[model samples]
Target chain A: MAFDLTLLTGSGFWNPFFWLISIVVALILIYIIYAFGEKGYKRGTQQVKPFISGNPEPSKAGVHVRAGNLYWGYMDALKVYYAGLVPIHSGILTDYLLWLFSVAAILFVLVVLL
Target chain B: MITDFLLHHTPALLVAVPLLGAFLTPIIGRISPIVRKIWVMGTMTLTSAIAVLLVYLVYTRGTFVYVFGALTPGLAIPPDSGGIPIRIIFTVDPMGAFMDLIVAVVGFCVILYSLSGDEKRTGLHYFYTLFLLLITSVLGMVSTGDLFNFFVFIEISSLASAGLVAFSVEQGRAVEAGLKYFMISTMGGIFLLFAIGILYGQYNALNIAMIAERMQFTSLDKIALVLMVVALAMKCGAVPLHFWTPDAYSLAPSTITAMLVVVSQASLYGLFRFVFTLYNLTLNYVTIGWVIIILGVLSMVIGVTMAIPQKDVKRLMAYHAVSQTGYMLLGVGVGLAVLGNQAALDTYGFIAIEGGLFHIINHALYKGLLFLTAGAIIYRIGTRDLNKMGGLGHSMKYTMIFFMIGALAIAGIPPFNGFASKLLIYESVYLFNPLLAIIAMVVSILTLASFVKVFHSIFMGPTLPEYSKVREAPPAMLIGMGILAVLIIAFGFFPQLVVDSLVAPAAHALINQGSYISAILGGA
Candidate 1:
């Protein structure tokens, strides 16, 4: 009887299940901060030293993975699809309205019977 | 008597009021700079009030027919049975009224934003003039009862918006983008004209209801449907036909770009009016659903993929606009697919349709806010490039917060307005096709990732030396974006408010075809 009551009510907002989640979240956050602090302390002690150039002088590591080139490769692939949509200059405006008229007229006939 | 007049005149007023305002703007602009401000503000405010009144009246009194110059735009309301409706007409249904309310609200915001822009670039008087005309035409397209009237309004809007889009073309690329938009849109308009000619040949009447009455389906019907599908697909920026959208939207002034997003939506409205009201919704017509769904799925997949790589923020937002459109179309396509199924499927269809309609409203809010926020950023930083931007959050805190809110809402994150509507769409589509649902979910996840990237790159990073001098957006732009952000949260937190007030009525309008027919064809 107690189990059944707990199962149903526990699913609601005040469930004991939430306390478990909160404790887990707090522990994870604490762990992350501690790890960051340890990394900083190690760096200060020169235990994890920065890389040096061939001349034995320190220098910043270069960033790679160019973003612009990747985008160009993708665009090149889509060129075929773009080619098919070549804009045709047709100047017939009245014909479009006529199409609208006939289609709307047909539907009106059928739906009005409802 | 007043109710009767409204029933008969609301549609015309929807168009006429804005057109009149557009016309009066030049004269008003001559009086004072403040006069231009007052005219635009007052006209939009009045239109907004009228839209609310029109919506209320539609709910209470059912459908009302407004004849232009006493001419029914479509079917003739004869002195007796079997008489022709001689005048051009405007039909006010619950759906049309809802559209009016949307256009009015967004149109008002655009006008307000325009006020803060550089008057020389905007050409204050002409800007408001074109803006009002655009509003009028959009309202007219939605509310007009005649097929021809819809075309006229479409042209008015297309032409005026094209001008607005290129308004900032002191730069050559902007001009090129505008010209591209014009050429493509002209092609669409021409195709539409051909389709209309075929329709007119079949049925002499130009009024929508009358054509519905008089048209007898033939081989021409199929041809006309195909033509209209192509034409409207181009207009709505469906996957294969959507090329012009990004360039045009990216090149346009930010406020104008926001307004232009609604162009595709209005085209969707036109598509819906065509499909549900003009074509047969029976299962016998499986071809229509297949075509629409295929296009929708393509748009969903392609639009998001394209958005992923875009470095320009406005261009990225433009691609997202296409992807968001895919959501609306997906819902609509699913609804069409399940039209003739039993009550169970019908309920799902209604859910999908209502979800789609509701998403339109949600998209307008967040997307508009997103663009306005983008505008605010551009206003400060003088560029639309994301790579050029970093750590803007420190300088433009409020704008960043609001932009994040909008971005999250658009990504359909839970507890936001986008999520609520998208949830309904996902559930309903899943009921119909699990595969389609999977695709939609994949798209949603990708959308979320893309926006997260935007937020991180633009706001969360360390301050860039270049942007350290930048300040927050002006008060007016901030206020506009802030209002939309609040609406996003409010609607997100309490979806029932929207579901009850807007979605329910719209769903009823679509589902209860009998009510529409009876009201228009004259009582039972």
Candidate 2:
């Protein structure tokens, strides 16, 4: 039944069944490639060991990237933006209330004056 | 014999069953735990059945109204003051029925999750009671045709939800969160009440239909509009006014946080009702519409940026909730902006609102699923810190799968319900402004990037020594999350059917003010 359905947007349309077909084709091709490969592959073995330009892999704890470090470069680049943004969320109830009233006042002026 | 009566009084019964059940929950709890669980689930099941039947009836029968205190239940019997009905009314169009369906599905799933998740906590009876009451208020908010009744429902929702937010006595910050929510809600309520009073003063009516029919967009009306806009926007977590959202959402128990998503969208429904129905033709569409668009843009940009840096898993999801709300606002606001121009309205406006309405249901499903998964993780590890989690996919395989489904869906990846709706939004809203659409796409990328970080942190790497013993979430929780996951997948596959059957009629019902007013007052 889904094969007959097409979701129309204002600019274009989407057919999920087509996407499904593509994925199925892609998977079958990959499987065919896998069928011809050597059967000696083993997981978590020396075959899978990392050789990053002849440098040894770090310990597991060091190797496993923490959530903090996952986007460290991104965060560092945006520190100036976040410097002005994160402090807006001061975690103080009074400051939150102040922000609410300030927004309403600005809207009131905009709506009334415009 | 019984079916006809229920079919007739379905709207009233939908709200009444839950309100009565909520009060009776504590008494039933004294009997036995199993009986209480059965009672809560049964109440939600019946309410959901009624909601579905009402939605089906609306699609078939067109819009209808039921007067509470009238001599004839269907007719709007006038008081001695002549021709204007003074009783409370539940006038449900496809728009209201659409909202009711969202409330019903998410409400049942949340109740299912709460049963297993909070069974061991103290004062569990109160938790069920408050949850049922919150369901009652949301149903009432969406269905009521009276402005004053809408305000009453908002107050009831605020009281019940604030209590539930503070119900997690295990969390130290809950009381602070609840207190701040109460203060913020009370302030919003004052503005809403003031707006209602002004409208009642001008039109001599409390029913939204009557007032809408008699609307005069005067200076006073503009004042009331500003008050109502700001109040409802704050309630729904639009930017600069979204300060209370993260605190309230992250501190509530995970199941309750899931339900709170629907509640905030109820406020959004109220905002749409006010702008589209009450001030449809006469008001300045361009100015008011652009105002909403700006609010939505700011909310989308700010909410996601704040979400990317959070270490608390629940808090990050809470920020995403705010971010997602912006998409709905943007789509509908585009519809409103071009409402005056017939050419533009036909070109992209209707699809824009349909996209918004579609996203409302989609967000409720995936966001609810995501929160439940987070709750499952927290229930297992007794912590909310992402820095402290790892290798959960080894043991809690089902929850990991459910979380992946939700995370990908929320990021607007293809083959999920979120992409279907967001696609509608992006393609349609671009016709209005390319910059806004670009901003939305950039937000989607950031959402995906952040979620990749989350998945890698919690599910990848070797199993942590401390968490190696953590098992799967209980069966009831799994079933609850599974309900939403199946829905997300099905909606993904059937976007055309969903849009034609549900979203289009809802957008039509919202934009057609005459029909809403006529359902209560008289002729088309």
Candidate 3:
């Protein structure tokens, strides 16, 4: 019943106990770091003021980013790719069927040829 | 003695109990809504118990064939038949039992969640009935040994799920989604039937084992294989043919959406069954395997990319579901590619296949939990739009915690169930080809990034003035999420226990197709 997949060289990921021990050791290290950190900070004071290159702080609602605006750079870089791919998911029934038929045809040809 | 009786009749009872409950739901609803709720929960609990027992029986006793209407379960083929199985048989192998276990556990949790989550909707009786029937169809699809029976169950599940998808008629988009789902499923069903006809014409058999035993691997068989694989992959939401997935998944009622995830996994189970058991290594393993691998890669990349720009929470999660499916396909595809090479298989191929099998269960648990959490949020907030919500963590603390758990689990963070299986795939698949493993790791990072976006938009930031009065989801919904949450933690911590008892055995059953064919034809 012991399911162990021994990888190359005798090391493997079969023992959950190893993971448990690692987790405990990591937690202890984190606790030690937290204990050594600065404390006695006060909220709602100039000391805790927001810093943004010395610019005035914006309203909370305005600063909260929306999901659509979060990944702008990634989307912009992949613009051409999205232009080709997004239209395929055009939410049309005919396009869906067309894709199914096209994939079937391609797979059939590949299987037969190979 | 009672265990013997139940074990003997497990296959029939697995399908029958839900079917009977489905029919009786409307009648019981007239008596009292409370009675109806109790009835649905009681039925699913009973069915879940039976599924566990069936998996136990299959794992302990090996593969057994239960022939319908026969005096004994072992009489799969007629004595006078010329080595052909004429009777419809229910083949309970380890793989089938594993799928049954998934359907049972997820289906039961969904039913429990719906009790409170859907309490205010009209036509409660019909909803419960279709839900039960959906469960029955999924169970039938996985357990049946006959190809034609599998088709019948596929149709039933398709219709039931489409009906549930359209349940929210108030949203015109739901109706549109249901229509698209029905049309796609109808096309899939037709192709499935045509493939079955081709096999029946060539081998004169509808039983999967019979056709597999007599397979000639002719040109016609090649055509059938293409048709079957494409149709099942389309049904399971593989990219290029997965347009129906996001629409159907996003539009369905949340509980039903959870069930739809399981439905897609069932179709995936069918795809693997056909490839590994029916075709075995007879076909061009490298070509077909690469085809699957390429499909997996596209799904993984495109699924995550599409999810990034989505504003609707459910639609975003739907896309992630597709991406997660790619991992399963990738792991198993690598296994298939090296199927005929015993040296490669012994070294890393079986591990890859186990990784895929392990991901199947993990995906079902985490994805199902995520959907239920989305439902709980929508129940309180009245909107699935991410931009309109913030700071739900203040009022709905438990829901926030559950969502965090599901989010972490789905993103493949360590110590969760997703990480264990994914780690197996990433390590072992590098041996096959480093690029595939690299792409998989990149997809994992993207998945985590997307979920972080979701967590920040919905649960972080200042509390929205509109949702200040929003309360936590009801106890029943919390209970449903709790079941999956506890399981996620258990499977995460005890990965070896699950791999040993379930995934490894299931992977072995899939690779060893000789035993499957011999079990049916050995007696004859």
Candidate 4:
């Protein structure tokens, strides 16, 4: 009884057993809702195809977005941010060492003084 | 009787057996490649068993030391008898034993995964040799009580890992990545050696316990501390010092990439061992702790943000590895920050560090599984570009499930091991400072978003025409992945069991510096 398997995060406890059970119940509920609708829907047809601004995608490939295109807007939003962050990962060994030694230099002063 | 002998000699055997097996691999390969594979697997099984038994002993019997060779590292030397004690000590507290378990599990699984690589490659004999040696080095690193030997193990691991990273030499970039990893590691190793020399000059001792026993925390000591911190921080892929990580991890054989995750944690082990065990109360805890937290926060934010837009699956995972490493740093770093105030320490400090430590093991399993699944895809479909991968879930169902388990877990999703640790970290670090906790949570969200992109890009969508005939990963590879997958789920379902049984005791051992010192110096 002492070490019952419930993780006590400082503020609360997480019992995965309860979480798992709730998940199963929620899943059952989802299945029931799903079962009620979409019974007439068919697979491998235009029913599954994407509706674009006006027309259906021409082919399956047109609908399947490539991974390189997945995070376009996210990258767009973070252009300035990545500009600053990505350049530091210039893949140059010198710059890498510069970061390493630069950190060592700063910490050298801080550790000594503080 | 054999158990008794093993109990006494586990530390030495843990390092030595694999080292010997590594040297024997090429010779065994001469006999037959199959024979060499058997020999390497046999050696690892025995080593993993030794690790498990070591963990059991350390857990039940409390912390202990194993000494080998003639002269101790400037400790308890009979003054008149003369020779400098060149001895090595392996001290296995709960923490060391915890690290041993991590390497053991990851090492065994990676060896299994490497068999798939071995079938396609020619220099597999050399591959197994370096692999075993890397395992030996990490095991020795975690278990060693002496600083010099720890450095020795670090050097050996870096060399072996550099070789493995360049194993696919046909690709020019693998060579490039290996060179980068090698040079960075060499520089970090040099800094570490200089720091060790400084300590040796100041204290005349190479044993961690011996130095901790007599730490003066002078200015010279601070210089040495910064050097060691930077070196180990670089080794573990802390943000600014983490440039080598994505390159090395992305380019390494997937098996080696997985093992590299554990290897970085060994450095994390070294970093924690230094701060908590060596410089616990003698130094300015708050300043150093805050320093670690900042590094962690940067790693979390920068690493994840870089990950989101990456098209390369492994490189993307590599960035996330950098991000995940931040959580460990944040969690334990919080614990370190709170060390000055006994009330704060008692209130949430231990929980925070435990969160960090727990994350280490969790990260190893899921991250390793993710890498292996990436390898499996590369094996069948022959590309690491997530854009090129699709419908893999239809063909490679097991790998897909493993990837899901790993992805969900890494995202800190519930009913998984990552969530448990993240929750612990979130709640505890919130007590220390709310902003850091919020940053950690935001990082987790980004992590989930990035992994979602990965899942959609790589495994979702229709089975592309080119990959329609792609078979599942081989039995050995699936078994390798299955081991981690099972553990991930088991750990998820029973996070508390793992924490109570494995994590809390390790945290206790880490913070109780007096015990570590006394265990080594015989109550000085």
User: Whole-model Cα lDDT per candidate?
Assistant: 0.73, 0.91, 0.90, 0.90
Candidate 3 off by > 4 Å: A1-11, A14-60
Q: Please, what are the lDDT tens digits per residue for candidate 4 over residues B314-337?
A: 999999999999999999999999
For residues B1-524, could you state the per-residue lDDT of candidate 2 as single tens digits?
A: 69988888989998999999999999997899999999999999999999999999998999868889777777774657376868999989999999999999999998898889878778978988999999999999999999999999999999998999999777779988998888899889999999999999999989889889999998888889998999999999999889888999898999989999999999999999999999898788888898888888888889898998888899999989989999999999999999999999999989889998999999999999999999999999998888888888888999999999999999999899999999999998999899989999999999998899889888898777788789999999999999999999999999999998989999999999998888888852
Error of 2 at B47 (Å): 0.9
Model 1 root-mean-square deviation: 7.4
- Model 2 / residue B369 / CA error / Å: 0.6
List runs of model 4 lying over 4 Å from the truth. A1-3, A37-59, B70-86
Residue A99, candidate 3: alpha-carbon lDDT: 92
- Return the candidate ranking by DockQ, descending: 4, 2, 3, 1
- Point out the higher-scoring one by lDDT: 1 or 4: 4
B176-205: candidate 1 lDDT, tens digit per residue: 777767766776677677767877888876
The candidate scoring highest on lDDT is 2
Best by TM-score: 2
Relative to the unseen true structure, what is the C-alpha lDDT of residue B50 in candidate 1, on a scale of 0 to 100? 75
Supply the global lDDT for candidate 3: 0.90
Error of 1 at B473 (Å): 1.0
The digit string of per-residue lDDT tens for model 3 on A1-114 reads 444422121126544556678989999999999999778778777867789999997866676677777888988999999999888899999999999999999988998656
A3 in model 1: Cα distance from truth in Å? 34
